[model samples]
Target: MLTLHPNSNQDVVDQSLPVNFQDFIKSEFHDMKQDLTSISKDITSLRQELQDIRIAMGFINDEHNKINEKIAKMESKFKAFDALVTTVEHLRTVNEKLEADCNAKDQWARRSNIEICGIPEKKGENLLRITEEIAKKAGFDLKMTEIDFVTRVSSTNKVNKPKPIVVRLQSRYRKDDFLACLRKLKVICQDLGFAKNESRIYFNDHLTKFNKMLLQRAKVLAKERTYKYVWVRNCTIMVRQNDTSPVIHIANVDDLKKIK
Candidate 1:
């Protein structure tokens, strides 16, 4: 049984109010602490995710740098390769020019010689006497002293033909005059006492192997194009459409384009 006055009741009510307020403060503090702990967990998870992203970015950057390095190396190699190709082309051009010069000099050395073809080869043939007989038939006064030497050379092809005779003359003028006279006469084997053979004797300027090949090419091209003439003079390859046309000189393989 509790007895209270009106002021005493007010004092009890005031004391109970403090206890309720303390309980309310404690509950709010607990809720706030839980919220702070949840926030800390969320921050830790974000930090780990950020660390993963940083690692990924670092790997990508390193790979990008490596790719750049490889690209730079490839560019350098390409430049060096281009330079090497240019040098090789220059050397090739120089070598071809030198070879042409050497071939020209070789042909110049053989200027005073004549090549005779289609003459039957006799086992005990006196080439000089044969030459003299041919000159006599052509009505040319070819003294024995004017001749330097005469020899039979093997044919360049595998065909079964007699070896040709190459005659060196002491004077290019004499050789030219003899060739002119022989061409005009159009002599044959029969003229040289080979009664059974009727093959025409052919006389020509002595040419280097290079010029000979060039002449053959020019002849074939001329025949294909219906050109009237392809002749060699002084080791030069000449082409003509006809007697009235201007002559074209062929100096190299590149000149084949001029045929058209």
Candidate 2:
């Protein structure tokens, strides 16, 4: 039988091989277990971050939608306001056009002569004083006929009558003051009971309908708007002309004072 030769090199190799093999298996398995645990933790953290990102994105989207709705509502309101502004501007233009047209057509009427009597105020006790002065200067009589006039007693103008007059009185004067003036005129007529006719007093709220001259005079006298005035008809002169003394002219409050 042939015997195998055992050298020193073979003996050392045999002893080291078993120990190195055991150490390699133990180290590899421990490293593999630690790597798996680290990978699991990383995956869990990534999932949590993804959930947080989705929640933040949803909030951002909701805010964007709310902002958009508010912008739309504001746009609608602005459109309505713009339409209203356009209508008002159109109406203003129309009003201005109409006023211009009226002014063009009524030029003569606007510039007509307006004579305000009882103006250029001369201070006096009553209307008779002014009428007498004007009559003396104008070469006319301050006398009135004892007959009824064509116009009513409350007629604002005695324009055609001789020495026509306008009167004004303080608005604060007592009701009794007006009554007293009328009573005085009536009493005068009673004294002249032999006369054919007498004077009459009339009252009306507005006098503009009967006479433009009277209205203008009233406006002139009402410089500070503190007084009121009116008109009256009367008989101041009793002259015989035709069969039963033709009526020459009518009288005013101022002229009637001298009737008796």
TM-scores, one per candidate: 0.76, 0.35
CA RMSD, predictions in order: 8.5, 21.1
Q: List the residue pairs that clash in candidate 1.
A: none
Candidate 2 structure quality by residue, lDDT tens digits, 1-260: 11224753211222345676655655665687678788888888888988989998899899889999999999998999899899999988897677546543442232211111222222443444433343344344324331111121233446653222333322313222332343343222223232543443222222233233333443343333433322222201222223553332212223222222
Residue-by-residue lDDT tens digits, candidate 1, 166-230: 89899988888988887777878887888988998998888878788888898999999989989
The C-alpha lDDT values of all candidates are: 0.85, 0.40
Question: Runs in model 1 with CA error above 4 Å?
Answer: 1-56
Best model per lDDT: 1
CA deviation > 4 Å runs, candidate 2: 1-29, 102-108, 113-260
